[model samples]
Target: MPHLHDDALTLLALGEAPTDEESAHLDLCPRCRADLGSFRRVVTAARQAGAEEPGTAAAADSDNPGLQSPGPDVWARIHRELNLDDALRNDPLASPNAFAADAFDPARPSPAAHAGTPQGNVRPLAAARHRRTGAWLAAAAAAVVVAGAGTWATLRAVDPVPGPEVVASAELSPLPAYSDTGSAVVDRLPDGRRELVVTSTGDDAQGYREVWLLAPDATSMVSLGTMEGTEAHFELPADLDLSRYPVVDVSDEPYDGDPAHSGDSILRGELDL
Candidate 1:
């Protein structure tokens, strides 16, 4: 079966049940399960942090009348130090784990200190300062994984994985009838199916151009279809034996109400496979 898409994986990671077909796929596919597990762990970590946070109501209900929220200067330093803007964008759940950046540093004299901050407020502020480091550290971890431990590990974690493995390639030289240059790349997908990626620098011709796999004898061919642009991806028909149809060909085709090859071959090459 083909792999699930990123959006589908994201939904599953958020604990939403997928469609019946997708649920069955998840149950059977190890790759998808691993990806879902990563998302779940991130969510759980965020929730745990939230539970540990001192309550806003508790702070409000305190007997100390002069206690104030940490100033803006404290937050600016934290954001700059940890790159929180980038982190929150990558992992929304990471916001819940955000630390109070205003950890009191005894070494640095705070403006609040010279303002004669009350002794009652000092202990709470000091404790908050200590927790700030842990908050940013947790956010960093969340962001790193969310960005996908680089492309390879990301592929290792999710569906549509690892790009296609190049199985064969061919460079097509223009025949006397045309001067265009082109190439063909054949790839083996993770599920063991093959794909043909055709690239060309030719101008769009009179009608549309078409692709084909020519027989070694040059007497038989399978029409892949009209080329839409300078590059296109086409799945090799499963039953078409590549051993017999090893030559890749491209021709200028016309809309003559016929599906047959135009017989006006412009570029051709033989595939190693």
Candidate 2:
């Protein structure tokens, strides 16, 4: 059977009971199960970060405008999935704990609280280790689920973004890739704001990753920003032309202090509007 759709996974993430057939499939499919968990994590993290933000109102996610990175524990999961190096957690200057204390609400656990959590404690990260990850649904029409071990918190969707009309979309394939896959979605809102929501994986193991809007000929490009996690939303410039920059590229970059593309693309895909 074809893997379940994003809508189905969204339901599963919200703890909606699946249909008999869907339940049967989930029971037997660890891949689907892990994907369910991962999306759940994104939603849960989003809500958590939202609440922790000062003066944030309890409204629909779209109502809560602007972008904020997920909390430390969530980044810890990103580290585990990307198999990223230790500097993120170990850098004495970066000081994961200090980053936590100052970044958001002190009401949330300090990074030190999570410090003792042994990385060895198995979290079924992004379809499990070594087995190739299959297709993923962006954390849309989404509810957040935060789970640890056998425990999970499933929050129902208050204002799930309507499955946006995919004005232009693409499936990203691996470049020098090892089990990395992603999708790029361009959605135009009623207010005329065009947003590019990119979901990427497999470069987490590298020190850092960069997102680019590439020219089809692989010549000139525009930098979006650094992807600190696997999923993020980048607002498209009103004057920017996508017809020329129709390709999405993510590259593995080291902390070499250079702001230019490293010429090491890990994933690439062309958009068809």
Residue-level lDDT of model 2, residues 151-266, one tens digit each, is 11221222333333446767778876456888777877657888887776644656687889999898899999877678878989999999999999888888989988898887
For model 1, what is the alpha-carbon lDDT of residue 231? Answer: 82
For candidate 2, which ten residues in a row score worst on lDDT?
Answer: 143-152
> Each prediction's Cα lDDT score?
0.58, 0.57
Clashing pairs in 1: 103-129
| Cα lDDT tens digits for candidate 1, 59-118 | 334475553333334334445656653322233322343322222234434445457975
Give the runs in model 1 whose Cα sits over 4 Å from its true position: 1-160
Instruction: Report the lDDT of model 2 for residue 183.
Output: 78
